[model samples]
Target: MASVAFEEIVETFDFLEDWEDRYRHVIEMGRAMEPLADAFKVPATKVDGCASQVWLMAEIDGTGPEAVYHFKGDSDAMIVRGLIAVLKALYDGRTVAEVLDTDAGAQMARLGLDEHLSSQRSNGLRAMVERVRSQAAGAAEGV
Candidate 1:
């Protein structure tokens, strides 16, 4: 996956004329996400704070010295799905240490997501990040 920076996404959003166009862009982004296998589709990884159903799946492979993480997520909300796609592209196939070390919240802020999102959406986004972070931490600990 190509890891586009948060700044790029923010710039793209800024360039859009209105929320409808933005929503279309977001849906397109979400459509780019690789499909998750049925085995990875579980309720436990589903985000609870979202107004729509959201599912996240993560796998940590530690056969080598470095741990690698693979993630997939789906959401009923177009923008939220796009946000998950962004997260997956950024963090997938990355080391657990890399994920744990990265300031994801700061990245999201840089993306201007908090300013653009409704309070409920922002909370849902926070929940998604927390879930990923917890998984990364657990991967690092070999859990």
Candidate 2:
């Protein structure tokens, strides 16, 4: 149930024979993202459980389960930033219900991230996913 953007990443990952190349591609994706404004980097948006500073500011359009989900994220670490970019592809522009329904762990597993990422990085990724889902759940409840 990955978005088209995320599917593209999966395809690219499949095409890249070397894990190192895939890793570089992820870093490139992070480099390509527009930096989150400093204004949105407040405590409210800061993601816990990350080794480096990270922020995720979600923007839900309309209300209820059908509301569209979007967010901007930034990280002090390049690899974490790349992981945020990956999360963006997975969830951005999707409806709140869709976001809620997504099996993020399974999707990320398709990229072999579970095997490749460090344990700390994996926990950070899970935290980011939780943050996104919590935001979507709030929107779904019209809160």
Candidate 3:
């Protein structure tokens, strides 16, 4: 969780220098992710309104200041899973407040993802982030 570096992703994109290459890199990111267990694909973990099926689980480590939020997620579509990877890079293993503080839309724009992706993919990506924030909110409240 939060394992990928933003700078590394930026460098990879910049080096690829073509939309097709960048697109492949995104797909590879998803392919490289550790597989989510099938049990996590249950209805309770599903994120609503995505064109592709998506599931996410938020595990709060503890109740105190040291609490960390770990997220596990998956998507039926390759691109969507890559988008989930982006969200995980920004959010997972961080405290709930830290996850909430990230400006994900700005992050996407900075990555130039907004220009290359389809509207449906963009909306689905936003839905993933919204689900993460909502879960983080719940964890923060519980603490």
Candidate 4:
């Protein structure tokens, strides 16, 4: 995960000349992802709106304003798993405030996700982002 920094991903995507290459890169990232544990795959964690089954877990690491975040996730689809990798790259190990401030949709857009993804996939991606955003907000509000 440390190797797959968000800025590095952006640069790598920029270097690739074709969507085919980009897709391969994405799939590779997904393949490299650490799988979510069976215990974490609960109904409450399952993401809505995804055409493929997906589970996302977001946890706070500290108290009050100092709280940090960690995320773990999985998806049945390779592309969606790769999309999760993209989210991980952007948000994992960040402070809750940092996670809340991050515009993951805009970040994905910079990678041309809107141009390349299907409508269903796009919606699913949004769902995943909202889930993470909600997690951060909930932590901030002490929910």
Top-TM-score structure, candidate number: 2
- Which lDDT tens digits does candidate 2 get at residues 81-119? 999999999999999999999999999999999999999
For each candidate in the order shown, give its overall lDDT on alpha carbons: 0.76, 0.96, 0.81, 0.88
lDDT string for model 1 (1-143, tens) is: 22455456767878986867766776788888765666766788788888777899887788332689878888877778888877875677788877777677777665566677889988888888888888888878777
Query: What TM-score fits each model?
Result: 0.80, 0.99, 0.90, 0.94
lDDT digits (tens) for residues 1-143 of candidate 3: 22357667877787888889888888888888876899889999998878999998888897643468888888889988888877777777888877777788887776799999888888888888898888877777774
Q: Which window of 10 residues has the lowest lDDT sum in candidate 1?
A: 1-10
TM-score of 4: 0.94
**Candidate ranking (lDDT, best to worst):** 2, 4, 3, 1
Expressed as tens digits, the lDDT of each residue in 1-143 for candidate 4 is 22248989999999998999998899889989999999999999999989999999987898654588888999889999999999999988887888888878778888998899999999999999999989988887777
Instruction: Please provide the root mean square deviation of candidate 4 (C-alpha atoms, Å).
Output: 2.4
Candidate 3 colliding pairs, count: 0
- Which ranking of candidates, highest TM-score first? 2, 4, 3, 1
Give the Cα error of residue 44 in candidate 2, in Å: 0.4
Model 4, 71: alpha-carbon shift in Å?
0.6
Alpha carbon deviation, residue 101, candidate 4 (Å): 0.8
Pick the winner on TM-score between candidates 1 and 2.
2
